[model samples]
Target: MAGYRPAVLVGRWGEEAQLQEERVRDFMRRRERGELLIQKIKSLQESLLQKTELSVCKDGCVHFGDTVLLLNPAPAEPGPGACGSLALAVPLEDSSAYSAAPLRAPCGVSAVQGVDPVGRNTFHVLSVDGTAVDEPIRFGQKFGLGTTGGFSAQMFYLASDHKSFLRFATKSHLQQVFLTEERSYLTCWKAAFWDPQLRLEHEGFPVPANSKIIITHCHTNRSLAVPRNFWTRSYFGKEYEVVCHTYLDSHKAEEDKNCWEIVTGDPSNRDGSMCDRPDPQPGGVRKELCEEA
Candidate 1:
């Protein structure tokens, strides 16, 4: 009643019945509008929650705006001690698992588990929306690429949770790569699709959907990697160890630990059908995924 103003009747003083009718008509109109607004909101929620198609991935092409899954192509390198392949995922906060470091391992360590690709592995690939560039991610692009004092012209992704972002930290002797509910400059990264065997450089420039690639932290220069030999147990069971470190002297095959295959879409959808190796364009077939440190 404080801010509410009753409808003013424009007619005569003895028109009490007419005034009552006008008030009822006004109330009905307000109720009708409110119901219409609610219906529109419900329709929108249904569309987003049960999407039929991803706007950026209709053709399964790796577009900038697509949400994706980063999967290690598995023992991309086969050593006697390799753990084969695994998908990187964040642990649930309420789950009963913590990083059990070696007896001498440092304190305050954070651990992320490598398991099969699932809902916990979803990420949104994003670039500046109002930029001059288009969305399809391309090869030969720099990842975690920036000068010490330069502005970051990089790409990054967010966890499906919306509030979280992937972060690379060197706050300790070990390079700590963890998922933070907060996003910052360190959340930035880039994609590389240069497979030595498949020929990285002729014109396979635009990264096709489902291609094996390397994602590097924008500020750390370390690729997201999983070590099959470094195993651990979680509430879910035995899982591989995931980290972000670039081996300075790694050989061609040894570097496969850094290789990840991007499967497009929300993890809830469980769709990786877009993953297919791009036919290396017919020209310069470079058989290396990295450069010398």
Candidate 2:
């Protein structure tokens, strides 16, 4: 209204308009780049989820992708490439009925049952006589006798009660009996705890279904052997020195049979009465039996 605007003022207003436009364009470009980066992050997350989905096992174990969560941490801390106390995860669907159920026992005895990762029961100790024996079979504890017969046979006798010195007559095949040491018969036996197939065979013949294998611990004291006088009263009448000759020259092929013999004692009484047998010499078999044999 005052005639006309000054040239300098007009020029300044034009410059301000151009600066605003440039700012708008720069903001738009930055927003576009930001949107593209967000889309790429979303796409990567979707791809990783598809490859490894988290799941839970029935035994209350968690499986995150391909890695199993460790329930019990190992004694030594887990380092790189080391699976800390990670055990084989047993799926809930594969759990056996025996393992899933709580262990039940009569009065005065407590039975604790736990299932292994493979869903096998770790506490069931099967007796050959079919009677349930709740006593835990310790790793290094002395077990019953392992005998062999001449016709290529092996038998296990459970050391159970006082009524009979050798309690049960449960017999298992030699092949089923796992001797930890082939050279020393006194070594601990390796019992099969878990075999998914549940078949232990020698020469195509499977072991008996009722056979209860014995588990052995290698680190335990080697002195945990069956006492020499274990079957003295049962086999003879009184206590007599008995020696276990696991290997013999005449019966080399039959290690199980004739493995035991009276070192010094007389079983002359048929009525289970103790006879006055001569004492064992420093290093000699029974004097009377030596002459006869």
Candidate 3:
């Protein structure tokens, strides 16, 4: 757990905004009128957790241009339901929030402030040449999350001013990973399979389809990971933070926190049991799942 400290170690960045009295009045008016509604989704289930999955991929190895889910099962976050495990997602779903929900405008993602957390968001795979072919993406090769004519639903992708790419920057020992509006060298990421049992890295092989895999930022050479304690309050409530820092304590280059299963084809249903709490009794999480973090 040496490298798994909760704090990001990176400085928080954002732009300034004016919180006008009118905006406060508007929020108060909305709160008084019962218009500030909170949305909730059913928590984590072993079978594909998403309801609106796009049919871009088939039941085989993950391919370039396939729309996929980055299903993360680490942290074992405590939430009502379905939100138990984390999934890589952006802050606001769309730009309509800034105009429609004026009180949130000052927090920064749109104009200057921002956030990246775990939620149910889909990403597309692409090679550097802009090819979204039916070919399987292999390990140790250059690929990226966002591409031309590919599906992207994150707030950054949906907005007009920002670029849609997952990028990282290393400041001192901390690697600050984030979504950027730039499509430069920093957006490149390569997948390396981690053996489930042995927790070892596999290179130069075809990445398995709909299986456990870890993505590394090409520029920082850090694995995409979720912090156990770091989090932020979002429109979707409290969500854990997403980072790209390789843990020294991880088994060989594969840590449970860094593991993300690819959601290729139909992620609609499963046995309908939550992974963390199978039994409905108090303190009923299975032994293996409740292992100390």
Q: Name the best candidate (by TM-score).
A: 3
Candidate 2 residue lDDT tens string, 1-293: 68676654644788898999999998788557544445433433332112221122232211111111112122233345332221111111211122321111110110011111111101112332222333333322332322111101322221111113332211211111121112232333222222213324321221112122222322232111111222222111222121212222353232222111111111352211111233465466777887898
What TM-score, computed on C-alpha atoms, does each candidate reach?
0.51, 0.17, 0.55
TM-score of 1: 0.51
Q: Show model 1 residue runs off by greater than 4 Å.
A: 1-60, 76-82, 93-117, 129-134, 140-173, 196-204, 248-254, 265-293
Error of 2 at 90 (Å): 31
**Candidate 3 residue-wise lDDT, 100-122, digit = tens:** 33212111121101111112355
Clashes of 1: 7
State, as a TM-score between 0 and 1, how close model 3 is to the true structure: 0.55
How big is the positional error of residue 56 in model 1, measured in Å on the Cα after superposition?
8.2
By lDDT, the candidates rank as 3, 1, 2
Give the true-structure RMSD of model 1.
16.1
Q: Looking at candidate 1, what is the lDDT of residue 104?
A: 15
Better of 1 and 3 by TM-score: 3
Most accurate candidate by lDDT? 3
Give the winner by lDDT: 1 or 2: 1
